[model samples]
Target: MTTAIAGRIEIVSDAICPWCWIGKAHLDGALELLAAEGLAFGLGWLPFQLNPDMPEGGVDRRAYRTEKFGSWERSQQMDAQVADAGRVAGVEFRHDRMARTPNTVEAHRLIRLAGVDGVQHATMDRVFRAYFNEGQDIGDRAVLGALGREAGMAAPTLEAFAAGDAARAEVVAESRALAQAGINGVPSVLLDRHLLFSGAMPAERMADGIRRAVAILRDRAA
Candidate 1:
């Protein structure tokens, strides 16, 4: 009988990044496939804000992209690619419905809270679904509160947590740490704190990467 190997996979990303959504979908597919194949792995989500200093009320997506990337054409092209990738992964990403790109500090904080609650995966999925599928303003307290409730988080607790600066400092600190670690982009997947896989890779490739990482961990344990 083959012994199950445990591995840690951390994904550093922002909620507003289209590529990050695609990468997440790919990772989800890979994990599901691996599980069906009897492979074992643990996943974690880390904070990385694409727009760390975005305005409190957020900025129009078109204006933000044009200013940051210098061209609407470039942004549209990238979005098209991301949409295609998401579709391939069985996710319906409604890019047209996304109006604004807000500072993801609060969203990251919620992820931190979810981690403490041991429901990080569910919370992250709710955030992604709210932003990408339902066209909800993830930066708003009401939307986040609903998302938290959906993820089985207590409403009052999450409300107080969001109202305060809880985990805000930690989220920002983690983002800074990721940047200092040479990750200047979203959708960076780190395996075992050593191997780095960037961008939205195919599900099969990610599964292979996870398998190799698990093997290394097993060997190290032995």
Candidate 2:
């Protein structure tokens, strides 16, 4: 007989959100710790757009962030803060290399497709790395298609999927619905479909939360 898995770990996040990437890293660490305790889980990534109203093709990162955050200096300050946190989490955030602040809906669509292909986590990681580390224009179809292929997806299949409106509306609608549900933030971690917490948490805190959630699930099963 097979042993029961602990539960599902789903992270609702946007591709370009730096904190979301940090949150994912922390969760990865938490999972490693949980594994030592004999807990196992199914992991999934869900779509959320940080800039849902961002225009197609995206815009210059410095200009967009400067306007959004009130000033260029302020934007840089925020980036510095994130970068410091990232170093602690073992993520190297290369904000200086980023030129475009992408409209992440297309990236989210690719993530949805990756889920169907059973390569969602790998695809999501590549997306995050491409955007945050390498400063790739992930808003572009060609770029996203390339990343998908790199993540074990067939070229023709992902290219066609990227060119079409297959997961477009679903991605947009789900993001909007999640926003309406008061999840006004990215990096929202959910256990068994219920929210565990929001924002980038340390690995130990996240692990403790997962432990409590698993205990609750086990009690229910009992």
Candidate 3:
């Protein structure tokens, strides 16, 4: 029932990235389509903070964007562009509902714990949905606990994350290492530990990339 094309896929992304969401949809579609054609893969999500300097609680999105982009209109333009891409990717991005841009350290902490619970991907999806769809502030422990519940994580597991006593240093270290290695972008997928490509590629393009990667690996094996 499995295929020789099976391999590991690591996605370096952030939960708040609209393009990352779009990239995930494309990669997921590629995986499903390829699985039907005898390819398989194990997926892992890695952490990257867009606003590493954000406070533990977070700040107002409007103020943050205005400071970062130099103008409210420019920020609006970028959001509109992301929203247009979201439409094409089947993501109903509710940017209007988001008031604050969260620190995301807490959210990443939750994701790290979810991996131990064997619900990392589910938790990641729930986090993205909670933020981009439901406008939930994922930086809060209460919101994270609710997302953990929705993702089927155990009660104690969620509680442990809420206490902020778990996976904090590991997440911080890994994030720093990746940044030092020059991975400063989201939707960056690595196939078998080698950089495949970056950006929100179309599903067909991703499938082609996967096929090529498998072929290259096979050649190396021979």
Candidate 4:
């Protein structure tokens, strides 16, 4: 039996979304499983912002939670569930350690820069860890510089980019386009720019979706 092949999977997600983190973990596991089975697929990451108008300095996590979710108790409940799910995905989510959630426009800008260097995935991973695990304010130029450095980007270049308004408009335009597409949330997976899979799905399910997508592409080619 021959294994199916598919076009690249485009993942639209925000760095601040815990579910997006879990979704990425699940996708990683799925890709590993596929690779072990000798299957192949390509991956791309797109930008999405949960809070587009967030200030550069950022807002306290607790305060943001209260404002967004109504109460601390409600927020904690959701956090606990996300934490448990992250652990299952082999991610150490240190929610309590997070101090603030900043506007991620600059972070997204860095991701775009990473794409030029072919290190977008690495930069995104570092940003997620820095924000959710290490409690770093991702909006800060210094912190972004460090993360960019970890992603193999030159510090001076990253600092200069972060200090300027580069890619800010592009980020906003992308966010607007996503909204127009009716994507109100993160972790949305698009296959072949048509089939849309929203939310964090299990690895097996995601792989199954990939297989299906591949089948569709094959049929189209035929």
Off by over 4 Å in 2: 1-4
**lDDT of model 3 at residue 185?**
88
Using TM-score as the yardstick, the better of models 1 and 4 is 4
lDDT of each: 0.81, 0.89, 0.87, 0.81
Expressed as tens digits, the lDDT of each residue in 132-191 for candidate 4 is: 788888888777878888888765568667678777788789878988888887798887
Expressed as tens digits, the lDDT of each residue in 26-79 for candidate 2 is: 989999888888888898987888888899989999999898999999999999
lDDT of 1 at 130: 86
Point out the worst 10-residue segment of candidate 2 by lDDT: 1-10
Is candidate 3 or 4 superior in lDDT?
3
TM-score of each: 0.90, 0.95, 0.95, 0.91
**Taking the tens digit of each residue's C-alpha lDDT, what string does model 1 give over 121-221?**
78888899889887888888777877887898766568766688888898899999889989988789887776567888888898888877777777888
Candidate 2 displacement at residue 130 in angstroms? 0.6
Clashes found in each candidate (C-alpha, N, C closer than 3 A): 0, 0, 0, 0
| Inter-residue clash pairs, candidate 4 | none
lDDT of 3 at 73: 91
Q: Model 4: which ten-residue window has the lowest total lDDT? A: 1-10
